[model samples]
Target: MTIPQQSGTFVLVISTGGTIACTTDPATGARTPTLSGEDLVRACGTTEEVRVFDAVSLDSSAMTLADVDTLVELAGKALGDANIAGIVITHGTDSMAETALALDLVHDDPRPVVLTGAQLPADHPSADGPANLNRAISLAADPLARGQGVMVTFGGDTFAARALIKRDTAERRAFALTAPLTVPRPAPAARAALAGIDVPILRAWPGADASLVDHVVAAGPDGIVVEALGSGNVSTAMGEALGRALDAGIPVVVSTSVPFGEVSFDYGGAGGGASLGARGALPSGWLRAGQARIALATALATGTDPRLLLGV
Candidate 1:
């Protein structure tokens, strides 16, 4: 079923290649992102009078920080246009959550920016790209979606960009909201650029030493995110390395490895959240490790202390 083109409410759809645009190469039998934006739109059965633009055409796993920045700029430009009612982005699901969050942090236009993608390739018998695209377009054109910020619409649910996370690698309903939508008070000013700062995630493991953490710090990153165990506890050695990172003025944000819980500086031990907090590490509330990394990088780029931005 195709959505009829309406006279008003113009929508702009941007396509960044992902599984949703993949097809099997006849000779090599390999899947690749070769479909054009128009092709996907047509496949989705949409007859809406919307503009389409191709931002990039690579599988999402191959997406770089440069691509993300480009997409942010493109979306910002489209949202700024008076003729465009809203924007829909078809992206690779692998990094859709991160890209969505990045866009959310930089753009404050209050216009809907809906992102959606398919888990299976477009040529697959049960491919979901068409249906997801259809829903994203519907959401984008909805007046109610405004002021709700960027959103990810998938599997019949619309999630705030700040709270979206990809919980499964292969499920159609892969993304989920792990935390409550955080409405930044005194709305954030538009960011001039998204500085692609390298912020690595260090996962704490049982009986693990600080060697890995030491290596990461030695590499000179703008910040580090520790995927702490439990309510934010790491190995004593890992904790020590985090302290060193903080001492060096490299901000460290601690996020829980658990799927659904807030990080807190409650326990008291060498590598406990409390110890880390005392040593200058900040809690990430309920954000998962990956999301925390995005927040930390954005904070560092904008010259805002992540601890304050996150309200730790």
Candidate 2:
């Protein structure tokens, strides 16, 4: 399938590759991006009024800041057109939260931009791709969703970009909210309120390492999240690196590797989790790395200092 030649109530499907693009072989049963954007549109069974764009074909793991920049640019252009009802981004669950937060900060559009993905390949008998895709489109076209910032819709719940976390690796209902439900006021009035909300991305961590933390501190980042081990502990190397980062005018936060849990700094000593809190690093009680990143970003964007934020 090829992208439609004309636009009409376009949904603007930006394929930042994931299991949604995969298909199983007839004999070998191997899955891959055998399906294209056009294929997805056809599978959607929606009218020609909806158009899809082959924005990009790389796997979600391969998505980068450059890809995010391109996506933001594309969504911005689409939102500018009156005929485009909304935008839908297909991405990997691993980094979806980060990308959503990033977009929410920079995208000033009032139109709904929904992000959705699947844990299983589209060809599986119990594949969740179709349902997720349908709901994403529905939410994108919903006037109620406008100005809510980027949202992740899964398991019949709509999550605010800043509060979302990928909680399950293989479950269909993977996206979960780290914070409590925050209901915005009615539309028209709510848009103004949303416009005032500040979300920032001080640092985006693909993985955890002390060197990364050190670099951020050296550059004078106000705050940063260290994706710590187990229940929020880092190796001796990473802890020392964090100390260096803190010494360089950077405030550090310890976020748990497990998306759901209370991060305790009870084990205070060398090469332990509690040592971070003792060393002036803040412990994000139940906040996952993604949530911590967004909170910190919002704080920095609003001109909050790391030392003050960490109670240092």
Candidate 3:
């Protein structure tokens, strides 16, 4: 699986824990994502042509926005180095899509930042980790992927960071594009999304309230997407703030804070899911909250209407 190492291309493979690094105990058969970067790289068998950098290692699910910023800074610095060609990040599938979008926003460099991971661990014979890594490495090393923004390579597909959403948990084919996701999309659509969606969550207050919304709006948010709790329930105060944002012509999208379920406006009344809707906060409906944010950001970045993508 060795590629002819390019003369000057340096590929940085950041290993954030996932099935790609995981191994199962023969006795228990329980799954885990804890393999090392060097081990995973050796398993992938790369040639001497491309130099590999084993970057920081951690679990993607437990990752924070701060981690994203740090990674972006590292990537920016790496790209600044004349020897580096591109970068590859092996992240947990759980929040891989989120990290990809965040990285895409922060790193303005055209060098490819490809994210890859598996639903199964490296120990499994049929595990998809090796292949996914190989593909990511190749794509990361490709000049065409440069200036294309961050990407997620899995199941033999190369997805734009802005268009991608991790839609599955245990399946190998998890990341997919938004509606009418192009078969082979290019940089324009990707950049269009990156412009506005790049707004990172600097901090979040637990109880939803207008103060927070005011704070966010005053900070000059083109739009704000709330990662609300179950069924889109936020504090009544938060709901009021949301309504204010809507009244002020600010677009607010509500997505479930829960990671694994469809966001339903089932809280009935009083600024619950339905109330949020009545207040003009668009419900994510089917899109995962994080992915929904990315789509909204991309739309805002390109001056494309968020309602158009939301179809609300």
Candidate 4:
């Protein structure tokens, strides 16, 4: 899977430790992030002056806002001073989309900032890391990748970093890109605003009531995203709960659990998208629950109305 190096502009490969860098822990028989950035670069078998470095080496599910901020700082630095053609970020698939969107929100440069990772551990005989990394490195250095915003190169697909979803659990081609609510929107708030900001996704299900929303509302979160059934429909009880959340002055964004298509407020009822829209809950068009939550958090952080960004 190693791609032979070619003569080209340099690419900066920043490793943040995901399955792409993971190896088996002989002691516990658990896979952990053990390989370093240099290890990944070597595995790429490229000689394109890919200067490699690391920012963190933790399971992506355990990544926090502070970790994302660290990467944002690094990306900003690279954009400012580096003469490299593009940047490649090796990250875990679990939370790759969130991090990529964060970088995308703040990204204004033309040089590509590509994110990549593998589902298999680096130590596995059939590991996919080398191939994915090679492709990412190539994409980052490609002139055509410029001005594409932050991208993710995985399983042969290159996609924009907006509203990406991990569609498969164990498949190599796991991530699916969801459409952004808008092409360009407000700028991100200060990194400080990303701290202590909470936006949780509450999924709607059979017999599900407002208890979940009520409990979260009691905690006084910044915002909430409801993953409703069909094209955004919830139980009457849940709709009332969402009303209470709005009454508490919290913004509620409604997204669809359906894999494809956008949320439309066509249905009108106590718990329909139309009712929710009328009740102050905004529809998250083309955004799944995960990215919807990120969008809401970004909106709350920047003091921008979530409706302006997410309403369909």
Residue 240 local lDDT, model 4: 86
- Model 2 Cα shift for residue 228 (angstroms): 3.6
Q: Put the candidates in TM-score order, highest first.
A: 1, 4, 2, 3
Which runs in model 2 stand beyond 4 Å of their true positions? 1-8, 25-29, 182-224, 229-241, 261-287, 291-312
**Which candidate, 2 or 4, would have the higher TM-score against the true structure?**
4
Which candidate would rank higher by TM-score, 1 or 4?
A: 1
lDDT score of model 4?
0.82
Candidate 3 overall Cα lDDT vs. reference? 0.69
lDDT per residue for candidate 1 within 1-312, as digits (tens), equals 122234566888899999899998779978899888889888988766676888889888787777887888888766656767789999998888888887877777878899999988888989999999999998888888888888898877778777567889888888887665553422453564555589998988987798998899899998999888999999888888788889998888998878875688898878999999998889987677877887787788788767644546
CA deviation > 4 Å runs, candidate 3: 1-7, 52-55, 182-252, 255-287, 292-312
Local distance difference test, each candidate: 0.81, 0.66, 0.69, 0.82
**lDDT (Cα, tens digit) per residue for candidate 3, span 213-243:** 7787777677778777776778777777777
**Model 1 shows how many backbone clashes?**
0
Worst lDDT 10-window in candidate 2: 185-194
Candidate 4's residue-wise lDDT over 283-312, tens digit each?
A: 887778877877677677766667654535
Model 4, runs deviating above 4 Å: 1-9, 179-193
True lDDT of residue 82, candidate 1: 72
Best by TM-score: 1
RMSD list, candidates in order: 3.7, 7.0, 7.5, 4.2
Which residue pairs clash within candidate 2? Answer: 200-297, 200-298
